[model samples]
Target chain A: MAAQTGESASTVLVCGEVRTCLLPTTQALDRRGAAQLLRLRADMYVRVSERPIMHVLSPETLTGVDCRLPASDGSRTRAVGTVIGRAALTEGRLLQTTSYFGLPAVGPDTRRPWGQYLVRPGIVEPFGMLPRKATAAGVLQGARRGELDTGTIAEGLAAQLCRHELLDRRAPFASAPTRLRWVALRTGGDRPAALTNFTLAEDGLRTVKLRLPPDVPASAAAGLCEDLALHDWLLTHVQRMLDDHPFDRADDSRSLAALRPAVTHLLHLWMPRAHVDGALAHLWDTLEAAPGFTRQWQNLVQRIRDQLTLLDLAQCRRAASSKGCEE
Target chain B: MPERVFRESTAEPRTRAVPLAHLSLELGHLYMEDFQLGPKRLGEHFAEVRIWADAVRARAARRVKRPRISTCFLIDDYFTRFSTPDEVIPTVLEEAGRAGLTIDYLARESGCAVADGVALAESVAHRLVESPPPGSYGFRPPASRTGWLTNGSRSPASPPRTDRGRTDWEPPVETAARNHSIFMDVELWSDDKNGQRVWSCSFLAAVWQLARLGLLRHLGEPVLVPREQDVAALPPDWDRLPPLIKVSATKAAFSAYRTCTLVPHHFLPVENAVRLVLDQVDVDTAALAQVAKRSADEGMPVPPEVAQRATYVFYEEPGDPIEDGKH
Candidate 1:
């Protein structure tokens, strides 16, 4: 399959962007509804997993491209190929879509027939030698005018799916969508895939870096990164929920309203590496040990629970005091 | 990695494999005009097709020790509804028989549009990822939405603000041209007077080619499955007929790793457009991989590109007979 094309030794770099947001429907879709929403190709199945959580993955689709490579040093390199994109709905509420492609160091001086490029779905071949460092940096920084921008493709897929008739385009709560830009550089030998850097930049943009082993496909790396992005977005979104409703609010219902959605829709979605391939799953440990994704999530869950408990106790005391005054 | 016991059938999607022939040799395509000319004209078409069909078989034999070859013919029912299948099938068979050419399978052109309740053409249209022109930067509207496919960049609809001084029309340039350009823009489909989408001949031809290559599927199941029916008692209406039928009791399968169509020179432009569509289509990767693996197992690996796997012979059109009063 074309996905294996990225797994080949020829692929020197793989990069992508992931956009995560709440499914805009008033209520989360059930398994059947999620399948209907994500049936991107009528002939293909919407892969549904029920183990850790109900996650539905749409079939991979391609977007053909012929444009200049994004280079930090500003060298103009024209490339031609397709970028692969797919959407996933976790618990039928968290909607995420990713667009990615792999690149070889060099290609034929001329663009081959489009059929040749189609067979290698996610590979964008440069017309000549690749400027690896510059291209990698440029992708992280984002594409300029006339340069390839993966984020657009990712956002496009998400928006297209969000517009499906099955979705009313009304969210249960207001939350900002998060964009994670990631790049994976090929590494030789038996060394395992490693997360080298992860940066939370301004404007809801997060950049991730990884040293990927040769045997690990770019898609697998992409899956791992998507997992990271989904969890990161969850934490960030829930934290924002708490921060928005300050404790000093005269009405406790405002805080309860802010945290209710998190408890209802997000608390159980923190299972990292759940869907990642076993070979690349270990990469999550790097981030887990440092910033501690699960650690922060647990803390948020605790805070939300404690807040709910306090609200319940205050209500009980008021009810008891009112009964005594009536007697 | 440690292994535990947990399984979900829906999560693990599988592609059903189809029986394959080494070469699927197309005899000739039947249109309303060709049939209108009567049996003599059909016989003439077959005679010319037979010459190339034999050559293709001989080439396939040389590639493998034992080549499984199938011959199929297409009838145009979508553009112009003609006589019943019962009335047409016999004449087509008799004409091919006169030329000593056996059509192993027979397919209606409409089958490419929709087969067995699946919107094959629309699904394929969605799969099209147009080749981006230089400086695209993921900003261009996709060709699928525009209902047009092109080999190069279309001339600007008057220049943008960046080119305020330019008033003259600039020529469209082929993205893969070498100092020269042969640009082509094909209308894949159009809306009819009733606002119904009318699939173009070239787009259907491309779908036909994909079916021949065994790269199409419906929910992980093979599509366009050729049904073995009693030709003597075939249906009178075209709608009652299956998309594809096995006409001959031949051992060869309906589809093959490669296809060679014996068509007239008049169809050159449509076939070229078909190539354009095939080049851009992202076929079912699993189906593609199955063909790749099976072909490799037989030591006759198919071409990596779907378009490359299709070959054609653009022969001269058969002479039309003078109209007789015996209509």
Candidate 2:
């Protein structure tokens, strides 16, 4: 009920019948002369036609009325009256009536023109043209589909609309901080503006400089670099293998066993000798303590032992063959 | 109740006594009566008598270092047939504690038979409990051109004793050194057939024996060598070996010993022999110095480069038919 004043607008206390009946004339003037007169009458009728209405229409409603000739015969004349009625106005039927007035004929078969009607309260502009509730819902639905609204500041408007119960006031987007922090650490760069910041650049190669923690050790930095490199290499290798083989059909247990040597090699490349040994020991202990790695661990152990034995035999055979050659 | 008296006896523990009878029984199974000559006379029957004698002495010294009194007995046959000096000394020291004798000195006295030496060592072991001599006991053969005399008195008058008088009754140091050299020669000779079947069989048998006796734990893993250059700058002990000596040794001892017999003419060139002898002397001194320096320079950790280089791959040929099929 509180009204806010706009630029160049005068303050006016509009209430009751006065507020309801005072339709702005500028809206009607937007149409053609005859259409404008009919629209004005329609708007006036609509304002006055409440169920227990107590307002009279002003005589100025008839000022812009005009006639159009029928095409059937020049002699034949039809009288068309643009009437303002309370019943028609209360139900928003005035809009159709105004649209009918703009047509050439006043017959049941004639089609009504759209946007021929003015909206009321005529004096006060209808409390700021609200975005339809359905429109707001549509915006949210579009956002969920990853279709961003570029033209309007919908996010801000949405935030305001959802400020009450729907959204968390404390952290509306709590995951954002963690996501940004991860980006900062992993990329060694400044936190980006938003997820959209990444999509803005065509190549997605915008590098932002970042300040690291003051106390980070050089060795630790080197180690992180090495680990990342190895991890990347291992990921590529896995991707390649997956691409080459029927990975979906392979048994998970067999696949994991096959990956062990590569994984171990990667881990060795990533860490120092002491760390590698400790990691291996930890892995062994974990595998022993947990039932998950039992099958794979046993298979690997047997394979390694068998390999060693085979190597020994091969060496013996080679020695024998070389001796025979000498003889 | 009367207070229990905790008596502290001044006398040494009786467990210190050597069970010579037990050792004699064990040795009886391995050697003939003639082979039972004392450590001093052992050189006559065995090529490298002095090395075994020294090993016994060293073993005795090590045992005495421990608080417990222990005696070690060496079977003459096993002692004489060892492939290397490294093998003999360590094995004797490890097993010494099991025998009842508290090893004191390992002496080699000429003229005494093995049985006589065993008796004399036992008597000396008994005396050790009463703070007796700690040197080894062995017999020395008489210096005369003739063999050992049956009668105690000789026809000729005794020669004038030298001023820095060492009696003929004591074993000479020169004899011990000469005996050690001979032992080394025998070890080398045995090692010459390393790649032959006999050598392999013997090596495996020795390994099995050591394993059964729980001595194999001390032997560690075998060092693998593939190329002559790998052991080119071996430690002082191995330096005496020629550039190709290690390769030849490994081939002869491990492979050829099992497959075929190689004559000296078949493998050892004159140039290789000369180079091997010179390199052996230099390498042995360097190795000894390096070991001493290693212990002294405890703060600076030695890199494992030397040990890693020592490892060789005996057979690194193309994949076998079975491997190709698997692929």
Candidate 3:
């Protein structure tokens, strides 16, 4: 463990990542099942709030880690601290876990008691002065074998929850899960919350790096990232469905087979920024302006709708012709 | 946001607070090996333990004018079933009296794993979050393979840790090492002949830390609540006994804001592993908040990290008149 100086206790570079996956049950959990499924700890009930969406938030949990800080310049500064993790269920269909922690500007020269690290639940104190720009770049670039990477922690947590006995080990659709690794480099209160970068990486991983005003807690960054990851997952999943049928009007059965899950499970799930806090909502705006998350989602939905329409007409003609023959 | 909001009873989250004390000081933990060594071991253990127990009480006194302090002892019945509690209780009490120590609560180690129809150990196991080694970029370590916890990235020690057929060996790297590594990987549990899994001594000690810290809850209620030990004679079997037995009248609660443990050097490694487990456990937020609030209100706040709330003094095992308790 890095010797925790007073400076590290008050963090400077706050970074974390969120991973989103499908609930493994054959059917999406109802409100009751969602609560039961997300009761990660036996002691506390899952936080189920109903308004925009019936959302469930599990109690926060911790994972301890000691590893080198991912410095862009390759200056080796080891860090030791606990990363905080929690799960959120959206409408009982999407399960997401955000595993995140932060590093302070500088730390004490010597390591202290482990209890000291536990007290700062989600904050991983760096051993020496932090290189904010380089470390953030390194984190965005992803871990290089031994650097501390929170996305794995987030994914690990989601995987653990998926294995719960409560889950039937069946998913309604066979869609790939995604991890959105995020970092919020704290630049003090003078600036507005601005997104630095959001990139779709290979192998079901997404990276988001941003700058936040001091007012927005690192958790807000996580919330924004979870929202992004969840919606991106929905898009990626539905896109795969559309990918199956390229409007080959002759092939009705295969198209319908592939598109059925998209309509049944995912179409209505597209309500972006439903749960993101107001402070960090603008980050979604940047994505909306550029490639536009909702635009791509709308296009995918249209493709699904267009294919389903073709399938609908094909079914109607067969019924009418059969009726005429009977007459 | 849309209209027609709905809320379910089970969905709302709540954390019922446990009775709190200023300090929860553990007198000692005695394993079967120590027990077989006989009453002489108990005398030496208690004699050495009494020294630090008083120092903790005095420290607590400075925090609160009359600190609500509770002292407890743990007997290992989980790893190996030994003499019946009927025989064990008398000797323990007798030895405690010899040291002028009044044990407020007597607990069984098995209870830390399960008590009162709750699978406490499994619940805790589900809560384990791996500490991220540096370069942890979103890739989760496979923790379940060996049921082990480590302070750093593991070396390619065994087939389970490294890929099959890869002969290249990698040194286990401690994330927080000054230079060279003091790598420690602890096995948390293994399956027995009946295929029922058994938690290792290190993992149980971690659970013991949570219990002592009063961070454990089962269905929003405290686990291992002390039952008054009115029955002078304990049951013939360990299974018949309640997990926690209160031995003497005291205003203090079993759970507290801080915990201090006195253990043998063998436990030094075990305690280190316990810290590894503890660093990642997400305790109930409401419980954490309550402790934070109370501690702040009392004008002596605790470290925000859960693991930091615990303290341990690892000394050489009982043999000679114990010199200044070793590290």
Candidate 4:
């Protein structure tokens, strides 16, 4: 295919038929030049042949043998195959190649025997054109080996391939600078997650500022607020547990068992015996009078009772410890 | 008693029509004279006619004792006046004969015996007076004083200024007809609310009652004679009344009144009610369409949530290649 195009270059034989020689822009034939070359080939073929003769031959057939032996030099006969191979290799190196997964080739003076063929691993003598599958595999393998950059791969595949497959896969992970500043504004100084290094004004409002990653779009701030709201509920519940048991010092690790003391302490502060009685009456009244309050009130009452039990146990332990210390 | 009556026999005529200027003087004399004249004058003048009517009614009622009676009449007074008496009366008699035959046929078909036709007619005529025809009792009240005042103030005073209080007053032709109909209605129904008479019969019933009472013979046909201006202003097809005349007329009058009076106070609620009704209807249609669209677009059976939330189904615009790329 490279020889037919009159440019020594690698070529793709699409659907085992038309030869498409791929040359660099500097060496490629312009439209008018290609048309002239096609006309010349037709004239030469018609004038040379008296009788029609067809041969099913591979590009390799053009090398390795000289049929007119006595009429040719013996040295020339030995060098024919090597000479042909060298010429073909030079052409392949000068040209570019492209791959088409399922497209047929088209060009003047091209013949296909079976219309389908597969490529195997090995250097085959350059036919009139390069096989489509072989060329694609070669470029893909080059990329995998880092012999070709992404740009080269893109150029080779540009004519017949889509870029989505290359783009859609996960890129190498890297952290970028944060773009948004987030501030957690709290009312008091004793908050567990407080940032106390900065001084507050006379109004006593404190804000703990944090940065959000650049990858997190501004639109996602709403989602962050929702997540923070859930986190706030959980954090409040945990702190309440820690407050209930004065002796049990727990760390920030959020385990249900560790949270029990805090929950109990908070419940005792929020609801003493008198308060609990009042809450129960209020809950009963609410459930009876307002249908909306029933489920929430039931959950609240259960939570309160559980915390009270834990607090009572903690108090007993403290009382026992005091007595033991006296003894 | 005979000698006392003889002594008073030479008394002067107690009642006489007075000139317009002496109306008050005449009325006072008549009132005193009537009080002294006793029951004899009352019986001879007013009570006698009523007694005669009661005697006729009692006789008719005694002759009929059926649980219910219905009668329809086609009085030919207008036909008699407009056409030859010979031509019109015979046609009416023929129609009445045909009606009687039809009723007999219906009674035979229903396996019922024929009752007295005169008694049925009398009872129906009496009931017709008691219950005024539809579209009778209602009167569109005078147009508001504010509208009259505004129109009066707005218009240039070239013509003699019309009384604002008389904006709704009809011309003599219309007023006379209306007053005559009112008088006949009062005489026919003889309605006494709290022993104070007020005619409340529907227009059609008054016409029917007048025909039954033989008043139409003395008064001529009671053509409705809509005001000339009103007739000119009527909407197209006003001459071709619909079968639901009563309903249509009441609706027209009520709508007019609503526009004049209730619009300011109740406009918002009425508009909201209409909007709400329309919205409910639209929502139902939209929901159905949405369910269908969802089923088609998703390529899955529609879920209940989709059906519940779907407001409308619309064809998606053809996918714009550029927009598809952006997404």
Q: Which has the greatest DockQ?
A: 1
- Model 1 spans > 4 angstroms off: B159-166, B320-327
Query: Residues A213-318, candidate 4, lDDT per residue (tens digit)?
Result: 2222211221232222222222334434445534335322333454444343222222111111111122223223533233443455466466556666766888
Candidate whose TM-score is highest: 1
User: Candidate 3: which docking quality band?
Assistant: acceptable
Write model 1 residue lDDT over B209-280, tens digit each, in one string.
999999998888888899997889999999999999998999999889999999999999999999888988
TM-score of each: 0.95, 0.16, 0.74, 0.13
In model 1, how large is the Cα lDDT of residue A75? 95
Model 4, docking class: incorrect
| DockQ, each predicted model | 0.66, 0.00, 0.28, 0.00
Candidate 1 chain B lowest-lDDT run of ten: B318-327
- Candidate 3 segments whose C-alpha is farther than 4 A from its true place: A1-9, A16-99, A108-115, A141-181, A190-211, A233-248, A251-258, A278-327, B1-12, B26-64, B79-101, B124-191, B199-203, B232-237, B260-289, B301-327
By descending TM-score, how would the candidates be arranged?
1, 3, 2, 4
TM-score of 2: 0.16
Q: Which runs of model 2 end up more than 4 angstroms from their true locations? A: A1-233, A240-327, B1-69, B79-327
| lDDT (10s digit) by residue, model 2, range B153-184 | 22234544667784344221211132332111
TM-score of chain B of each: 0.94, 0.16, 0.88, 0.17
lDDT agreement of model 2 with the native = 0.22
Error of 2 at B146 (Å): 43
Encode model 3's per-residue lDDT on B145-169: one tens digit a residue.
6787777777755534346655666
